[model samples]
Structures are given as C-alpha cells and as structure tokens.
Target chain A: MERTAFQIDARDNVATALTELAPGPVRLAGDGEAEQVEAVEPIPRGHKLAVKFIAEGADVVKYGVPIGVATADIMPGSWVHLHVMRSAYDERSAHLNLRTGAPEDTRYE
Target chain B: MSRKEIPSLEELRALRWRGYAREGGGIGVRNCVLVIYTVKCAEFVARGIVEGCQSPDVQLVGFDGCTDSQCAVNLLAGLIRHPNVGAVLAVGLGCEYVQPERLAEIAARAGKPARWLFIQNEGGTLPAVERGTAWARELLDELRNTPRVPMGLSDLTVGAECGGSDFTSGLAGNVAVGRFFDLLVDSGGTAIFEEIVEAVGLDWLLLSRAANDRARAELRHAYDKMIAYCRSVGQFSVSPGNFAGGLSTIEEKSMGAIAKSGSRPIQGVVKISVPPPEPGLWLLDSTPDPNPVQYGITNPNDSEGLMDLISCGAHVVLLVTGRGSVIGSPVAPCLKITGNAETFRRMSGDLDFDASPSLTGELRQDEVARLLAELIAETAAGKPTKAEALGHREFHIPYKYQEKEARRADCERR
Candidate 1:
C-alpha cells in the first residue's frame, strides 16, 4: 500500500491526514485490507482520521499518544470534530473511565 | 532487576559537548554587536546609524515596546547584557519610557561600552542619523580595542519557536527540538520559547511540569490569560491547519506544540521581557490580545513571534515548521528546521534542518537531538543558517488593547 496517512508513532492507532480524503471507498495503509468508512464526520486535511473502529469512550490517539477521549461512538474514517472531543488538559467535564486507562481525576473535577 | 536509567548529566554532556567545551560560562558561536533601539520611535534613527557605519560584525534590532516605560527599560538593559552582544548602542526618542541614558549606564556597568543618539536633542532624523552613525563608529572602535576572549557553551541562550505549523510539527520537528532544548537546559544554558497563542491548550500540563508550587501557580495564571485572550479572538486557539490535521481542541494542539519543550522540569514563568535567571524550562506569558478580531494582527505569528523571544534577550532562535518559512532576524540567527520530508524536499532551499526522518521512525530521538545541538553550536560560531543566507529581517507589532478583559474571559471560563 502506498504510504499516504502519517503514522506518528508505532503505537498510534490513527494516522494524521496530510491531504484531503475522499469518502466511500478507501483502504488504510499497512492494514492491507479494503475497509469502508461512515463519513459520519468529515475529517479535514492536516486532521486525524481513524484507521480502525474506536469505542464510545476510547482514547483518541494522535502524535502516537492519547490526545483526547471520544464524546460519542466513532468508526474508522469518521471526522473527529471539536464537539465530539474534549480537551485532555483544559476541558473540565471529560469523564475519565479508569477501566480504559483514562485519568481518574482531572484538575477541573 | 530494574533496567538502568538514562545516562547521567556528566555522561550526556561529554557525549555531546565535543572537544571545544568549557564550564561556568556557557559556550556561544557568534560574538554579535547588538545595536538596540530603546523605543519604536527611535527605530529609524538606529537603523540609519547601523546602515551608515555598516560594519560586517554589527547588526541592528529593536522592540515594539514603548507604552510601559519600566518594561522597555528592563528589556533594553537585558539585550545589552546578552552574551552574544560584544558591544551595545542604544538609540531613543528623548522622552520615551526607556531612557537611552539609563540603558547606557546599565551597559557601562556591565563593562560594555554604551552610547546613544537622541532624535529630539539632535535636531531631526538626518542630523540624528549623522550623529548616530559617528557615535556608532566610535563605539565599534572601542569594541575593536576590547579583546575577544574565549567563551563556553553555558553562555548560550537558544530561544525555540515555530510558526506555519501542521500536524507533523508537534510530532516530528517540535519534539526533536524539544529534546535538544532539554539538553541545552541541562547543560546550564538557557532555552526559551514563546507565542502565548500557541501555548493556549497546554497550560495545565505545563503547570504539572513545574518543579515547585510557585512555578505551577505562575504557569496557571499565564496560561489562563493565554486562553482568555484566545477566546476573545473568536477563532479557536487551534488553527485551521491544526483542525484539518485532526487535532480537535486547543489542548490537543498544545499537547503536540508543547512537546517541543521535551521532558524538562518547569523552573519558573516570566513575562515577555524577563528571561529565566538560571537554567531550566521557563514559559513566556504570551496571551492573545482581548480583541484579536478587531485588531486583525494583534497576536503572535510568524516573523513577529521572534520579537517576543528576542525581547527577552535570546542569543539565537530555533524556528521549527512543517510548512516552510523563509524569513530570519537581523539580531539573532534563526535556524529553520522543517518536519515534513516532502515539504523539506520541496523547500529544502529555505530550511536548515530536516526532522522528517524522526517522524518516519528512521532516526532515534537522541541522534536528532545531538545533531541539533551541533548545528546550534555551529550557528553560534558564526556559521550562517538558511535564514541568515537569505537575509530575513522580520519585526514585531506593538501591543494594542482590543476588548474588555472581563467580558472576554467570561465566555470560556473553563
């Protein structure tokens, strides 16, 4: 597969979108399998696009680390809008699910 | 049994510092003759003087500060004290907040020959230019008589900066620079980075990194102001490129941006003109203006970003970018490093370092860090960076009030 998306770290589950992505038919690099996306959200260029299905409260990864948590259920190729994600540092209301390895208590809490 | 920890300070320093190393005073690459304008009004006069004298070793630079007399005075004094500056010349509008006479006194106390040209006393621009040029010649002659002595690595203050960023910035370039910045700080040299707008989301993380409670509180206050200023601007702290690159919140963007600092203990926090007294990670309190929408260009961005860090007396600036920039400063040498391999290839002519391999996992983090340290030392030794070769002389915009702070802070009280 041609390398298109950026793999920031070997540990990262998502690859950052360096170019504007098209919907409907797409395949993730390295995965080697053709997978479809919901386009439930439109990911812009320079934004992160999920390479695999993420749970409702899973850690949304970027730069090969957990950047934030999902506010709603998400799928591969969905746009991670601001509304659906809360800040890992500044946002107060993000519930850290201990089972999923999120911080149990945030400063705002 | 536990694995051995990372290399000790002495080992790391020996591995990195080459044969040309010294203790006590930090090492610097270039010995610069810093000609600083005490106020914005005196800028043209100072430029004229430097241009007229035109010595190969001399360079002209100034600040956008004038409103706060005290801040301006402190900033100019610090610039004259900067180790890279072998000599100093301060020019001013006679009645400006920072008096050129006071600056001269400070420089003289520091054992550097200081002189000034005042526009009001010297008749006008042309006359002042003539007098200023003559004074500069005398000052350079005095500086020439002053002996050039050997210096050390600890004498260096490297200010890190980034602009025109993309996702690759935080991951590759910023992180690589951060590792080097950590090393620079550990070596007892000062490493400074600014742009309150870019610091928007990572305040709390920074606070946590603070070595003490006082540092943490200062970081909190500065960061809150930064966020409040960003909110006033209406556009989210995260830029369009950040959002497009998949960062959803200011914190997310900040997490990546702040990564350039690497893993270092926050020693303290400071205002724009104040540099860290000793060596440790420090934050420059850079909040956006209250009404960025009204002012259009109130906050820190490319070119102008150099002023904030430089104002604090940075000897050189490390400018990292994913989208390439061509500009550099007249005072401090700018080392331009790019993160994107393709972007670096496309714009290799303008960049100094290529950080793409770090992102691609081809280069170990420490190797890249060592390379950056070597480049920094080389640039300080008068090795021209891409910016210097191209002659990029960017200036800063003066501060202007745009909105009521109370109202601006109310929207995102979070």
Candidate 2:
C-alpha cells in the first residue's frame, strides 16, 4: 500500500504528508506501528500534520526535536504551520511595521 | 546496514587515476593554469585573457575588495598553490592592496610557472588584454609537459555542501552523501562538512559523535559561538525558499542539513581555511575565527562556501541541492546531486547524480551510498562534472570587519 504520510522519527509528534490530503481520516506509520488521525484541514505535501494532540505552549516535535511551540490548542490531525505554531527561537510577532521594523500591538495575541 | 557489502580498503585503493604530482606530497586531479586578478579593477582584462586562451583547463578567479586583507591574501595564495594548478598568471591594477607580484612570487616559490602584468603599467585595458592573453597561452604550453603520476583514493580530500535545500535533501541527497563519507573515512581519505550556522539545533547530537574529549569541547564551543554570532546579528540561517519548500524553522532546516556528515565520529574541528590535522571526518568551522565586530549573519552564498572547502585542501566537492544550483568552483570540481526527481529531469544538464531513488523507495540508503562512491571514484579519475562541462566557474569573497578584541569578548561570553 502507498503511504500518505511519514513519521520521520519514532519520538515525533508530527508526520509529514507524502501527498496533498483533503480533510478526512489518514493513517500515519513509521518504525513499525500505525496510528490513525482525522485531518482537520487540507495538508499540503511536505507540510506537517499533528499526529498527537498538542496543547497551547507545548513543543511541536518533529525529527525527534522541538521545531517550535504551539500558539493555541492543536488537535490531532490538524495542520501544523505558522497559523497555529511559531518558531521557538523567533519571538517577534508577525504583525510588524516594515518601515520602522517594530512589532505592532494587535488583537488575538 | 551491514559491513559485509563494503569493499575492502585494498580493493578500493585499486581505483587509481593519472594526476599531476605536486612538488610537495599531494596529487592534483586537474593540471590547470590559473589567471587571477589582484582586485576587481583588473577582472575584465583577466576575463579577456582567459576567454582568449579558450581552454577549460585555464581558469579565472579573484577577490573584489581593494583593501589589504590578510584573509584575502591567504585565500589567493592557497588557490595559487593548489595541487590542481600547474601554474598561475597574476593580473593587477597597480594601486590595489593585493599586488599581483606577491601572488606570482608564491607560485614561483612552489616551483610552478608564474607571470604577472599590471594593467596600469601595461598602458591600460586593450594592450594589457593582448599581452595577458599571449602570456596565458605560454603558461598553458608550459603546463602541458607537467608530470602525471598514479593517484588513488587515499590521496583525495572531499568536501560536502548543501544549498537551495528542500525536504528531499535530508531524506535522500544528504543521507546518501553521509553514507559516502563513511566509506571514504573508513578507507583512510579525508572528508569535510561545513556551515556551522545550519548546525544550530544539532549541537548536542553532534557533540555526542565527537572522537574525543577535546573534540567534544571544540564542537561545543564552535556551536556556542555560532549561536551567539547569529543572535548578535538578529538572524538565523533559514531562508524563505527553504520555507516554501516545506521547512518551517531554522531547527527544522538544520535537522535536514546535518545528515550530510553521515554517522562517523567527528575527528575534530578546524577553523576556516585550515586543513584537518589527520585524515578523518573534520568539521570546517566557517564562523570567522575571532568574531569580527561586524559580520554578515546569513551564510555566504554557495561559491564562498565552496572556496572555503577548497582552502581546506579538498580536491573535489559534493554539492547537494534539492532546489538545484548550477555553480562550480575554479580549482576544485563540483559534483552536483539532487534528490528531487522532478528537479533532476528539469536540470539534467546541470546535475551529475540523482539520489531520488531513495525518496521513491526504489533504493535503500546504502545502495545510494554505493552508487555515489562509484560516481566519486569516476570523478576522481578525471571525469568532468556537469558544471565543469557547462563551464560554470563562479567565485565570490565576502567582506567582514576583522577585530581581535571582538573575538576575545565572544570567547569570554561562552
């Protein structure tokens, strides 16, 4: 059977979509075991998908390392990206004034 | 996965090629003459001379800065005396800080044929171009009689670099090269991997693989310096293109990049332009030795990285690109590899090896490694890479402030 997504490491909480997948049930497997997760949104190829539920301020694990921390509660099979996650090393906000290079105080923080 | 399939060192050493014998103890895979400009001002005439000579074996390279930089002088001197070069033709604009005469003297001291002509002294552009062309042709003729000796894998030092990366880079391209590094190291050859900025998140993992206690400390210090350097500059090595290709953060990109080193215990770390003390897997710390007061936070472009590898005495560089780049170096031959099957098809003319089979699950990692080893052996035996065939001789030298005090402060902070 052709696998739709791959877990890079056994300890990873996220899996990389092998192909573009529409919102639905998807099976992710690697290093022997298989787990099923419902896709909450469209996941593009090479993009990350939450294989395990992650809470706000929790580390997003991939390749057995913390790629970033979640900004909000992320359910299993939800698309993992900039919208719901942010780089652990990068503290600057997205809403920045290009001219002055300063972060703007905004809503939904 | 098993050592049963690995070839014996004796069998591997049987792979030999005819190479130019250096006066000292080294073998040059290419017998070429270099036409180098002392400053950017003389580049046009230098290019004219190389173009007029019309030979792939005659290459042109130079620094752009006019200021006297010890780094630039050392780099130019290294290139002039590279084992691959049989002779040198130094071009100058007369007023630049790096005099062509000094480069010529270095080449001459190494028993290589060297000549210099100043653009200002030769009555400007046209006459200088004509004279330079004539002299370059003479140097080519002189190098034709250079002796060729039998050389093998032990005499080679190979460098690995990754640029324009995508997801397949880690899973396929870099993984395969890592396998090749293992084979090369086991066979008593030198292999180098650089770009400490890309190594940010892999520090502890890398430190665990250091050969000894001192190496572990050096690895730790180098990684700390890299992180400090990046923080001071308010930037990281991740790029927009990397994100577009699916990498989300510097740590994610680093996880992919570090796979190029394979699984060998890192022998030690050496500063930029310094060759490894012994033949094993060594890390070239591309971070400026003493942190400069002002430095470009981002990794320098591919060419500068390639030159750093060459400065460490690499005879060839394995350049892995998932997004695909076509650049090559002047003295060292670059073998371009890509793990994207689509990219390989699109840029077949520019790429040399395709490790995409590893991505498609058609070939195992060890199989890809074996294939790369065969290709590397062929390249060492004088096969021109795609970049060499397409005539891509790109060179660049970056400028950064050199301050000893800043380096001391950086060390103290660590």
Question: Model 1, stretches more than 4 Å misplaced?
Answer: A7-13, A18-45, A54-59, A63-73, A79-109, B1-28, B38-41, B63-69, B93-97, B149-152, B195-204, B232-236, B244-248, B288-298, B400-414
Count clashing residue pairs in model 2.
0
lDDT for each candidate structure: 0.64, 0.80
Task: Give chain B TM-scores in order.
Answer: 0.81, 0.93
Which ten contiguous residues of candidate 2 chain A have the minimum total lDDT?
A93-102
TM-score of chain A of 2: 0.75
Which runs in model 2 stand beyond 4 Å of their true positions? A1-3, A25-32, A35-38, A92-109, B1-13, B289-292, B401-410
The residue-level lDDT of candidate 2 at B199 comes to 85
Candidate 1 docking class: incorrect
* DockQ for the candidates, in order: 0.21, 0.27
Worst 10 residues of 1 chain B by lDDT: B17-26
Q: Give the alpha carbon lDDT tens digit for every residue of B1-414 in model 2.
A: 112354444566678888888775578988888999988999999999999989998899998889866666777777777788889999999999988998999999988999999999999999999999999899999888888898777778899989999877876899899988998898888999987788867888999899998788878878887787787766677665676666666777788888899899998887655677799998877776444355443457888888878877789998999989999988989999888877889988999889877766777777788778877878878899998999998988666432222123447543
Model 1, A94: alpha-carbon shift in Å? Answer: 19
Q: How big an interface RMSD has model 1?
A: 9.7
TM-score of model number 2: 0.91
Q: lDDT tens string, model 1, B1-414?
A: 012233444554553322212122433344556677867788888888877986655677765566543433544565566655656777888776666777777767766777776788989899998987787787677655444444434667778778767777876789888998888887887777765555654566677788898877766766776665555554444454555445566655666678787788877766655667777777665443333233444354666567667656677898888877887876678888877777788888888888766655567667677777777766766678887776666665455432212124433433
